[model samples]
Target: MAYKFALCLTLPHNTTKMKKKTIILLILAAIVGLAQFIRPDNIKKYENGVKTEDLAGVPKEVNEILRNSCFNCHSSSSELAWYDKITPVSFLVASHIQEGTEVLNFKDWMSMSIAKQKAVLYYSINKIRSGEMPLSSYILAHPAAKINKNQMQVLEAYLLSISARGKTDSVKLKALERDHKWVKPALNGIAYMPDYRNWKAISTTDRFDNGTMRIIFANEVAVAAIKAKNINPWPDGSVLAKAAWTQEIALDGSVSTGQFVQVEYMIKDSKKYAKTEGWGWARWKGDDLRPYGKTINFTTECISCHRPVRENDNVFTIPLNLK
Candidate 1:
């Protein structure tokens, strides 16, 4: 009887081990299957019709570092990675590249006005300092992209130098100012209108950073309680207006100047208008609103992501853009 009991216990142990093995194998299979769906895409290599020239004065070390670590996403000629060919991973990689390049494309660096370029570089420094660059998850996969303390210092120094140069380039400054004219309007708290500018509706998004606010304006008729009726008959051509602003809190608990500002228009099948679907953000100086930059950070979609802020009418901490 004792021998029989031992046999029974041993058999169960073997079965348990086999079951654990099966689970692990299944998980691995899922990961592989998901990878197959993420085919690598070389879509970001499009030319922007901008002229490229030698960086005669740029520090070789800084240029090289950026080329290897940042250009992959921040430049138009990003080198495709081996894993980027797979499915889900490819999607994520493509998203990151799109976002990165939109925010600051090195290949299009010459295309920006000097002032805009300086502003972007400053923002880049802040982004890196805040541990937001090379994105932590990205570094995990490509260890070579990791920036050590020394490398970070080099990058910061390079940005400072570039900013100084950018300020002196008046021609570039004028060009950039025109592109980012929305900053002037937002600073004075003016209502954005399509009539004044060739503005059109764009996508929306809901995920906003702290002390930021966004608003979406659309034809009230288009909204038409369609959700209640379980109908979405609104023409996809109907435009949605969107704007976003980032704010900072003063030491006295009052809101300071706008940290960022943006405006765009979009079209969507759904009647809802918010920043979460897709939008853009401006890079405004925290201390002073006059100094500003531009970004395509999907400000339109900011509202949809912040479901928790629906109590505030889907707005975050930013005050209303218009009275």
Candidate 2:
């Protein structure tokens, strides 16, 4: 009788435990079923139908590597894998795709502006060189996507070639801008950039304490006038380009001037700039290449700096030949 009573007690406990597990399983089933209904597959964004063929003449080798490794997330040609069809998996895949394309989408390559395209290409090359791309997470499941040494070399060479082409195109664009008088939106400044590289070098200044280096170039007419020291009232169109750079300790332990810092252009415009002085000032910083300061304040700092030398046409550099 006691044994029977013990069995009766144990039976209810076991039954209760079983019932609890069943309830938990039912709740999990309901949660999973509900989650499936909230699928993100249909929600489309930035679905520009840009295609691989759009990059028409891209080399087969580079195209192969890009399609196999990059297209999964970085292109519109994303062919979702089996797991990518699932709820959260789909969400993650979509998010990665969105992010990858924003950075460098091969499909949209041709449509991007030349500058933007070159920037993306350079960025991509740097990332590849650093071995930061073909993310480990991606390569884990897709061994074929891993880039080999030879493949990297091929990509680097191809990208450099493309970058060289971009440089040529940029020069042509600048020439067009110079001749056609391109008027950029005023950032309190003017955008009258000339081919200052072709101008004659007048002088160079280096200040090591401040890590600053400057090169002054002058137009042909200005140089000739300075040689004769007859440039008292400087004629119009006599522009001076001062390119600045930053001094840095290079990898070889040598101190050298690094990337461009700024370019200050002093353009002689007697009638246009007679208000403050006889010079129209404009500046471009770093890789921006856009002129800065369109207002009179541009002259406030400039004029004040040149005030002490007002006796010399309100200019600073008298040139060696002028002496």
- The C-alpha lDDT values of all candidates are 0.55, 0.71
Clashes of 1: 45
For every model shown, the clashing-pair count is 45, 3
List model 2 lDDT by residue over 1-323, tens digit each. 99999999999999999999999999988887677777675324323334455343458887787777787777776755666656666676677777787777787765454555556667776886787887887677667889888988888887766656557866864553344132342343545455787887788887677888877888877887788766787778788888888887778967677878978877888998787688877777655455556664765777788889888887676566733
lDDT of 1: 0.55
Q: Candidate 2 — which pairs collide?
A: 188-293, 188-294, 189-294
lDDT of 2 at 73: 75
lDDT winner among the candidates? 2
Reference-based TM-score of each model: 0.41, 0.47
Among all windows of ten consecutive residues in candidate 2, which has the lowest summed lDDT? 177-186
- Model 2 Cα displacement at 293 (Å)? 9.3
